[model samples]
Target: MKIAVTSKAFAKNETLKSELQSFFPDCRFNTSGRLLNESELIEFLGDCDGAIVAMEQIQAPVLDDVNLLKVIAKFGVGLNNIDLSYCQKNGIPVKWTAGINRQSVAEMALGFMLMLIRNLYTTSNQLKKGEWNKSGGQSLYGKTIGIIGMGHIGQELTHLLKPFACRVLANDVVDINEFCEKNGVVSVGKETIYAEADIISLHTPLNTSTVQFIDATAFHKMTKKPIFINTARGELVNLQDLHDALLNGQLYGAAIDVYDVEPPTHKELISMPNLVCTPHIGGNSAEATLAMGRSAISHLVDSLLGAANER
Candidate 1:
């Protein structure tokens, strides 16, 4: 059987490359170090039996052309990139594991919180320019933290924050009262969280109801001028609104690791000193990268090789 890996990052990992070859010698890997466009991606998987994908759009058009493709496996947690409806209608099995990178992402959010609170990012940049600004900002200890989604990464963040003794307020669409009670988290409405939190972080999934979840209206509701952090999907927050908030002082500061556009081109927003930006590496830690790659490989191995053995 042939296999194709669409994730450029995953394809570049030598460890993953070696491990995958041991199972299936005939494999295709994306080595361009750039995301393939629709036509390039379709041609790449033209003859593959199974595929490992990340961040590539696997919708009807791509699936329709890849007639030989058997199964689809996810390399990361997010499913918004893949077309589940199309896969389901055609009976294409998609194997995925959630929360594999939970610790890595949660740790990044914690780091962003610390950096934003202490003004580490801003002051460091100033020192680089010989300004020597000594504005040490607030501390993360005993501060109110609002987490928008209390899922795997959110729950893991709560565990990590126990040492800080932060007042954690969480709001989710599902019932989290029991978990909140056990962990000393307060289950509150989104309005209450926006009004009171000293630090606000988003960890929700990207869906219809959650797209543009935070906008100008939500920023205006933040009475505390909170430091904002987004390690989740970038579309969850409006890019223009976020820039305006940081510029108008509606938000104290922001640490953004994800953007609506990868390699985001908004120079005005990216050049802001108060805003710290990172190339979407929330789940790209050395440990997390290997784990996610291995998980995707496992799904493909099971769905194809294991099924072959059973037959």
Candidate 2:
């Protein structure tokens, strides 16, 4: 069987490559180190029987063109980029493993919070420019932390924050009452979180209900003017609205790891002193990369070899 590995990180890993080759023998990796556009991606997967993909959009058009493709095993947790309905309609099974990088993403979110509240980011920048600034900011201890989408990453972050003695306000569409009660997380409404939280972090998936969920109107609801952090999907926040909020002092500041566009082109927004931006490396830790790759490989091997029940 022929298989294509579309994730650059997974493709570059010698261990993962060898492991996949052991099962399939004929495995193609994206070695060019360039993010493939839609046409290029379709062409690359033309002769493959199955693929392990990350971040690439797999919609009806791409699926319709690739007649030989049988299955897709997602390299990461997020499935917003893939059209699940289309895949289901066409009988193409999309195998996925969730929460593989939960701790990695949670740690990044915690780092962002500490950097913003402690004034570490701005002070570091000032020092680099030969300016001495020693202004201290608020402490994370005894602060109200609002967490949206109390899933794996959110739960992990809550656990990490336990030593800090912060109040965790959690909100999720589905019931997480037992877990919240156990962790001392208060189940609250979105409005309450906006008004009360000292720090707000997003951990939700980007779906119809969540795309552009944090817009100008949401910013307007911020009575506390909290420090915002997003380690989740890029489209979850409106970049323009966030920029306006930072400029207008709607919130203290923001640290965003994901953007509407990867390697975002908006210089004005990204260059803001109060805002911190990263190149979507929240789940790219060495350990998380290995775990996610192995999980994707497991799904692919299980699905194709008729061991789906084991998975």
Candidate 3:
């Protein structure tokens, strides 16, 4: 059986690559150090029976074209890039494990909150330019933190914030009353979160309902002019609206790890002094990378090996 690994991070791990090759002798790794485009991905997966993929869009056309593909083991939690409905219809099972990188993402979110509230990011940039600026900022303690999407990452972040003694307002489409009660998180609406939070962090996935979720209308509802942090999907926040919010002081500042485009093309938005940007490394910690890779490999091995026995 042939297996293809589309994640560069997964491919680079010698232990994982060796383990996979031992299991499936015909295993292939992507040597290109960049995210694969749609055509490149389809071509790479052409002769493989199974694949481990990350951040690549797998649509109906790709699925229709690739007949040998039987299973896709997702390297991370998010599934917005895959065409799930099409895969289901065609009997192409997608194996995934959730919360594998929850702690890693939560830690990054916590770091962003601390940096933004303490004005550390701006001060450090100023110091590099030979300017001595002593700007006192607010503490994370006693602040109202609004967390949208109380899933694995959100819940993990709430647990991490316990020492800060901040009030956590959580919102999710599904009911998580038990979890909220246990964690002392206030279950609230989106409007309430926007109006009351001193810092707003997003952890929602990208779907039809949540694409461009934070827009001009949402920004206008910010009564507290909160500092925004998005470690979630990039399309969740509108780039133009975020720029306007910073310009008009609708938000104190923002820490963005994800964007509408990876390696975002918006130079003005990224170059703003008030915004702190990262190249989507929120879940790429060494520990998290190993955990996620192992999980994906487990799913691939289980599904394919089990199916082979059945046949």
Q: Against the hidden reference, what TM-scores do the models get?
A: 0.99, 0.97, 0.98
lDDT tens readout by residue for model 2, 129-205: 99999987889999999999999999999999999999999999999999998989999998889999999999999
Candidate order, TM-score descending:
1, 3, 2
| Candidate 2 residue-wise lDDT at 297 | 86
lDDT of 1 by residue, 1-311 (tens): 99999898888899998999899999999988887888988899999999999888888888889899889999989999889999998989998999999999999999999888998998988888898878889878999999999999999999999999999999999999999999999999999999999999999999999999899999999999999999999999998999999999999999898888888977898888889899999999999999999999999999999999999
Which candidate leads in lDDT? Answer: 1
Residues 169-206 of candidate 3: C-alpha lDDT, one tens digit per residue = 99999998999998899999999999999999999999
Off by over 4 Å in 2: 307-311
- Per-model lDDT: 0.93, 0.91, 0.92
Lowest-sum lDDT 10-residue window in model 2: 302-311
Clashing pairs in 1: none
Model 2 lDDT at residue 274: 95
Ranking by lDDT: 1, 3, 2
TM-score of 3: 0.98
Looking at candidate 3, what is the lDDT of residue 22? 78
lDDT value, residue 126 of candidate 2: 94
